[model samples]
Target: MSTPLAAALEKALQGRVRRSVPVTDLHDDIIPCPAADLFSNDYLSLCTDTRLRQAFIDNISKEPLVFGTGGSRLLNGNASAHLEFEDRMKTFFGAPAALLFNSGYDANVAFWHSIPQTGDAVILDELIHASTRDGLMASRARTALYPFSHNSAASLRDTILHVLRAHPAIAAGKATAFIALEGLYSMDGDFAPLPEVVRLVEELLPAGCGHIVVDEAHSTAIYGAQGRGLVAALGLEDRIDTVLHTFGKARALTGAVLLCSPTVRKYIINYGRPFIYSTSISHSMMCALSTSFDYIESSAGEELISSLHHISRTFESKLIAALQYTPSHLLALPARSTPADFPSNVVSPIFPILTSYPIPLARFLRNLGYRTRPLPYPVVPRGQERVRIVMHARNTEEELDELIAHLLAWSLELQEEEKKEKEKEVLLATEEVATSKSEPAKDKALFTISLPGTALRIAVSVRSFV
Candidate 1:
């Protein structure tokens, strides 16, 4: 069983084993058990929306459904359903043109791989999604990729300036400069300052040379008028060069669409390998996407968005209050200061409960019937490990209260444990001091009480006693 690949994989996965949790035994009726699903990306709870489900079924049943696309879009898979959906998306999202991809990951890969020709530069947020990085890595266009501080406008400006200085082509407007960003960061659960970022990009790069690309994977079906996304919400849709709206999250469907100009779409169609080679999505999937968008624009969808906002505000306020007295190093939220001029309507469902012991905290919550995922190093930066909690529109006040209570309980338990451990260390130090009292003067050594970094690594010196 130990082939060359197997051997290499075994060595590489020594300490980082990953496993999937099957959902066969974790359902409530036809949908996932909501009581424990705090990690799913279904922010709008559209997966369980009976109306959406029925609409999808009815739409697919309207005519003969194509279960699978025969070939790639460039081949026989270019069905009318795909074209109609793209047109609908362009109108709905207010984009000049729209192109569909299998998923957000696929769209990013295709776009990043095909766009940004030689001599161009792509400035990315340090914490941008891995798919973007993969696309850039696979890109044969010789485009230089630069990363700036996460969500920092100052850093972005600096990075763009540095790139311009380093590459005279970009400065002279002979090359394009693309800025990649996410509307909602999944790990830290923070919104990118889209307005500030767009403004900086326009000011730094040469006129008509700079392009802003935003991936609204975690923000779609949850923001703006009818969930048009942060770009549309901030009135910067005209300024942004390209936008990626994923259907997997709040829309509770599959696939993604890249909103760009007609020229860009045509270029991707010709050069994007993934789009040209991969089989297009089925007609049924297109029907489902159409249905989902229909529901999102409905009054019920508006009500859900309002409910989600209220829940987000309530949860954030309550959690902050609950953690007011807890030690920060043990468990706390990431210290993100909101700008005074930032929009108040930009709320996200993702919440990160920062902790040094993310796995233990996540396990504790899971044992209490709250399923949250722990993100460790590489997923998040070192020292930024956390348990990521995603809120849903279906989440009730009672469920939220119980979750908060359990979090508080965990925090209190940790505090009590640390207190007892400190006492034990003090007693042990005293015992060591007494024991050293019987030793000869020269033999008596300085005693130090050890503590973890969470306790500030207190160095209790018994030198005086000795």
Candidate 2:
């Protein structure tokens, strides 16, 4: 229910605007949802993998099954499974060390708060995930949100300069400046201008300035060699400082891993308040996460990745026909879309459908058994609200057909509705004009006017003329 404070908002809309906390509105239960699965993050459908299921059974049957972590890791929360998993990840990802966190949110929060000393500043893309901003807010470090580069190095440099100007300590080399970005941005489904930003940092930033941190959450388990993510795929392992890999997306798991230097790992273990204070992940969960990594290196995992990629490209190839739209708007784009996230570069299974009637389209699809994610105002900018459709490896061609057909129908209906709305406005304006035109001469004003070219003064009463 909406609170008394939400009265204006409640009255402003007539739809099912339930005042509630936010959820991605991705997909419903895996059991039975009477809708097309077009928005789930289970990209590779590994959640239902038989091997994973076997691992789950095998781990569950192990003697002395532990249900809890007992306490936080610093206390009695650490487990053998946790250590084993970390070691495997360290070796697997080729990082100096790997640290596990309860979840991506926890890892990011800890990193943002623990790093960046009071003198240091965090320079992030304006569209960086909210969790990062919240973490920075908790820190004593100076924070600056910069304009998105949209893949332009010059634009990124300008944004960094602006941040430096605002934080003189960073300019004077007294404080470190951390550049934050994502390997794959969730909303826009775009790749960050990482190389360019790193180049800028190398060329312009003062020595001992700071590090470039990245959230490879969405891209993990999808891109890169052995599914390390787009950063690894681009061979940018040396350029990035810290990388956050989430197991929630393509991996279909429930935790996160932070890849960084061993020194940084120790620092995080000690100073990362979130890790020290929160309950350590359970041994069972840790074991399950381990199995996931093992599966990623298997041939089945490789095949799944290939299939998912094929699905993404195939779906993208068909988006134009389904959207029935021009490639100029924020939502519409071509297959394998590269640069210009309005002037950022992006390529992913996510499709953002920008529309004037976003809520209606989402609702219509929902009624037709398609679960779509509608991004409304506040979630996105007012005019940039969109319907986000996530493509999955498990999704079939028939599902794509259904998605396209329904989307086309909705677009046509919206077009007609928009036309009618415009017609109504024009009619109202025409009526107002006609009323003024037919107002029978209230009073006539005679005026002496000189014609251009004739230069003759003429007295004329305009009221007498039609």
Candidate 3:
């Protein structure tokens, strides 16, 4: 009981908590079907694609399974499959070379720990993935988390200028600075204005002073040209220093790859602790990944990506129209402060709709048959709790309509709560007035009604959701 680890775990558990919800109460076979799925990351519907399943079976049937590589890639674990996967990724990403990692977390850890030299500095977005931040914390170099406002090029310039001012050694050519950012923010479903950031790096900072770094774990896999990602779409591969892409999202697979120069790859291969310590991916998984890439090149891949975007766009337009009705409290991003109108320029399939009572509302949706999850405190900041919805190619228009219907019902629920709360406040205020009326000896504490009681009934709405 007095163990240090136990004490730490106890401290960490002193709050509202979560538990794993099994698909079935007992086994995977007894899965319960939910109404609408809104939390999946399979943007392309590739996970259930018949072609991919066939490819997996074909590859596994033809090739002998290599079980698990018990050693790291730097050791005897290195295999032809591993090398081939890396090569294919490098070519696909248009990079000088590419390196593999067990997952995005490992890739980020290796990158942050090894790349920024001792004298170098790292300026990263405050909202960068926790994995990336963990890696930064493990690094030997100095690192600072800049504000999320750096998503704007102008703000990025200001933040860099401010950082360089404080750490003059970096600006004075004494130490190098690296700017780290996300290509497409996974949580907010927004972009980083990378072109502007890239321009700032190219013109404002010298080659030796700093370089642009991006984590494309969300965007590049299924968003842009031929599912290559934002970096490729913007032709930023030659400009940005290090870009991390993973198969977990759109590819519906495990593992990640880092696209950089062969020299940098060599450095990471030699010095990156995460890459050197962890066991390599399974041989069958590697073969499946290889086959998946092959599928990504086919006409089917192009159609799915296109279809996903179209469905997502259509869903967005419908949701916008629904949430904009009079007295609506549903909040969307880019208008965090309760905008007069929600933006219609949603380019991503992910959206975080704010809710004051997220868990109850989420549970209500779940019981009503939607697989919607509430993103609270640790997932997002407090008071910014949300119902996060992710669209996939397989999400039908009817399912989207049903989800929106539930959302509208929830919006009505919020309205009802607000109305009840308002009426209670009014009653309390009237009681206070009656108490003052009772207190008056003469005219000493005479209570006055500002307007007719009927007028008060028709009074203006109070500041609520805002």
Candidate 4:
């Protein structure tokens, strides 16, 4: 009964079926089983803050009531409120222009799919988000895309050199080179080497032709004064050409903004199809966004950011210490997992703890009331499967301690299971050896070979010569 399309999908998915299951209970808004909220992206725990919610309600009450934009922005969707928010974000982020999108994915797709021209080139990190890749694939300049090793300066330099050799116009300043990066990677939980990347692009590409674009989706409202992001934290806001900030994570709302030059803003307004064809953000969401920004800049927001950092550092230190005796094949951290590798003042809320047994580990933690999800192959690379864990301002020391204790218990249990399995295998091999030796040489053709590091035997059979 399988159609061609259905068969194709089955082959592609290979038994890995994804589904939409709500984490919350059917009757309640809280997470099911009353598990701790460590699996979501709400880093600052702003989603449940009563003050922010009250402020949003107040702002919504002042606005003219409208549930949805009637049409696309080019038609009847463009509101004065939208323009006002864009202006506010422009001034807040210290950018010349700002344009809103429905989500970060929309912004990335619109920007990457339409911006780079045929003569221009885009050199990106290998670990760039899938949205950016989809945009590049649909772009006219897709042929010119080049990916360098993740966070490797030398690889970036080589990629630039290759692009220059292949496209001489880029070297001559007749064409532009766009360097794409994420301020804080979602999966790896590591910061990009922005300073090093900026210097490399400036050194290699033509003086004014290299454009560095940073997507601050994960870092927005979590770093810098008033949550300006990592580019601002490093005092490199003036150097970066474009920055994308999404509000869904720490802001506890939807939509994103692209901060760029006035010229680039005008270009996207004209050429970006996602922006042109899609309805604008809702009126109430705009009010919520404003309230969120007001909170981020307030004194309470600063305290929340500090609390997030303190909790993150505590978790990282404890987890690293726990993994010290663990086998790399069982559990480990990425090479750049140490604090010294991150920005001096920033400790990311996201952690991608590597393990081949992600599903089992996540299930164990979830059963213990610490909710986490596994990222298996295809979401990440095969050997790099992990369980993504996030820290929030509200998570306390006692919670972390309990989670770690459960994790260690699981690890110990796994080790014990492995020991018993090996013993079983050794006993079976010994029985085989005994049986082989008892048989006559003419009737039996068997030999046992010992392998190093374990008391196990491999049986080989040979024909007896008459």
Candidate 5:
């Protein structure tokens, strides 16, 4: 017997959008349509670089290992190549040791679950990546969310103090407290105040009571003189207890590394479930990552970093100019009248256009041949739906101009529709209120009377005329 489709399936399929390029039935000589690329995470465009590709190929050819890891790293999967990559990363990021994971998600989960003891308390930023929060939930430690006031070090310190006071046992060294935060927040593209955080930890945290862990997933290959990430850029390698770096973004590869002290590395290696139970990353993958590390050490990597900086600056200027020309009417309805709806002062490259509803914004962009992602509820709380436009060094000036044009036109149209809807709602509400006010008052004398039975009953009546 075959499974039947649900009734909801038909509705879901009604307006489903397809990818820009068709994946199937491609001809050898066909030239694809020219669509501006705006929906990729390849910020530095390293994935498509001819030189990087050749380096990857060359490394694979020179390496002895190929194909899959037969078992986990603790078992039969650990290879010499894997060890080489780990050593290279450890030196590159200025950490005592480094351990590799298949992906950022796995690495984060593994670190969170393994590092904190049963009696530890994990304090994380409110807006941390979902993976980090998920990892914390899976860990044995008790968790608390601190308010992240858009790079306000004062807020972080205050929150930590509050938590410490609330949980005196943790402060007294009876329990551990771990502070977890990302060096660069994924959604906002803003960075945490690492220096201030370090100072706070040194000044406030009692010995054996707390530690700080920094997630460098978005910062890797995007900061530092050698692109070693923000931690290395700020000379905070020894200051942070652990640093998480990934190759999926700026590194343009698959896999991530956790940088920590030798003792911590040994502990996680022995206890981390993702590393213990799952098959290790393949040797071929290790070779690719090793090649990437080699490229970073070479002169070509310096040139790439310089190019990325120039590109990022150009993109920022173009975006700001475009925003200035956008009509004032295009602005979305002011945030709802609530404390949480208060405007934020944080500024970064990730541009979020708040909307009354995200579906309209998504549909409008789709119709204009631009792909904008919708960040709705669950990801963001209700009433904060927005269209997130991520910029990259790979995007060209012409593409940026085209995107701006489409956004301006779409905004104007949306504003018109919103204005009309508001007017209609106001008129309907006014009419209803007026109709209720005009209704005649009831006469009490007609329904009221005196009755005699076992006892006398009296009713006081008032006269009314309408």
Candidate 6:
């Protein structure tokens, strides 16, 4: 108890914080489990695609290497294959330069901690990914979080003005400000107001120094005609200062890339600790990522994005309708507010199933043979727990239908139970009112009553009859 680590460990255990279960084997369909896998960030089926397997094999044949990188890039680990992969990524993402990282977390930490100077300011969205926040905290620069109302350019502009006004000491040529946000949010599955944010940054830059950075971790290899990501899709590749793309999601592989100007690349390579101290990515992983990029360049990647969009749209339509209808001959329940109006130009393949209690939803789905993950508090703020359903191109239409059907069935059952509980409450209230009227002269006290195992409670006043 005296030790901080021991206290924290005890709190975690007592809180029953769930641990992530590692999968030893793979399967095609995740059904009949206690929860469905609506929480994965894997937007493309590439994670399990057969073509990627062949691509990996082909790359390994061309140049044989093992699992580990012997040293850092500045040391013996700097392989020619890594250089070639970076070059290919630079071309793919249309950046002047690209640098590889062990993962998105490492990339963000390296960039945020080392890139900005001590006098610099980082104005980031309030809801940016946790990794970016951790990176910003580790940085030497002064940072401020600004609420942009979940993709409102007007809000961002106001936030920028507020930050400048509040930090007058830094405003007068003492510091520079950088704006950071994600192209697509992981939780809401919505995009940032890039055009407006970019415009505001440019307007501010004329008066003072300002820069913009975007984390394209969820947008890469899934948007635009060539799958170049949201920034490229919007034709704002030249407008943003830096873009971070991870290979784990859409690329269905490992590693990450930080796309920036040549100057920024040089600065990071010279100063970034994660890149300098740690061993570089292995030649094999580099080659695998290279081959994955090649596959993206081919027509198959385009087709896959298109297929993913179609599946996403289909799933959305079906689920919305199912939410509205009754299942199993029961009355339907009232729906909560939708997360946000669907963006006119959606890019990512993630969608949110907003629920009051995500754990119960996950449990219900799991009982029906769907493998879903529940996003509880801490990852998201308290009271915003949700089931994040991600669609992949490889998922069959039939599987989607079955998943929807089970959800509809569960909803209907819950509705029936809720209706019964409400009726019981009404009846109890009526009895209380009747008793009070008959015994108006007697003093009465109100007592609370609960309908067992249902989300309904009632208060009743009792009195003696005259």
Top lDDT: which candidate number?
4
Candidate 5 CA-lDDT value: 0.68
* Rank by TM-score (best first): 1, 4, 3, 6, 2, 5
lDDT of 3 at 11: 58
Kindly indicate the candidate among 2 and 6 with the higher TM-score: 6
Q: Write the per-residue lDDT of candidate 3 for residues 1-466, one digit (tens) a residue.
A: 4999988876565433532111223432222345555667778888778888998888888887648876888778998889887878877778888999999899998888888877676777778888877887878774454554636667778877876776777777777778889877767777777767877876766556877779988875565567888777776778888888888988889899899878889998998999998889989788778877777778888888777778878887887787777242344544522111222222587777776556666777778766666775556776677777888877899988988887788667667766776676667556655665655333232222322111113222222111
Please say which candidate is ahead in lDDT: 2 or 5: 2
For TM-score, candidate 2 versus 4, the one ahead is 4
Candidate 1 CA-lDDT value = 0.83
lDDT by residue for model 1 (270-348), tens:
9998889899998888888988999999998998998888888888888888888888876788787554455687777
lDDT of 5 by residue, 82-127 (tens): 8987888777777899999999888888888787887666777777
lDDT by residue for model 4 (1-466), tens: 9899999977656545442111332443345347677768888999888888898888889888547878778989998879999999899989999999999999999999989988999999999999899888888889999999988889999999999999999988999999999999988888888888888988889898899999999998889998888888888889999999999998889999999999888888899989999999888887888889999999989998989999999998988898899877667877774234346678888877887677677777766766576676656778998888889988898887877777778778877767876675566656665665665544353555543222346654433222
Q: What lDDT tens digits, residue by residue, belong to model 2 across residues 53-153?
A: 89767866773755787999899888887888889888888888899999999998889888778777677777788778878888867345454555557
Give RMSD to native, each candidate: 4.1, 9.4, 6.9, 5.3, 11.8, 5.3
Candidate 1 residue pairs in clash (backbone atoms < 3 Å): none
lDDT (CA) per prediction: 0.83, 0.74, 0.73, 0.83, 0.68, 0.73
Candidate 1 residue spans exceeding 4 A from truth:
1-4, 17-31, 141-143, 337-342, 437-466
Lowest summed lDDT across 10 adjacent residues in model 1 is found at 19-28
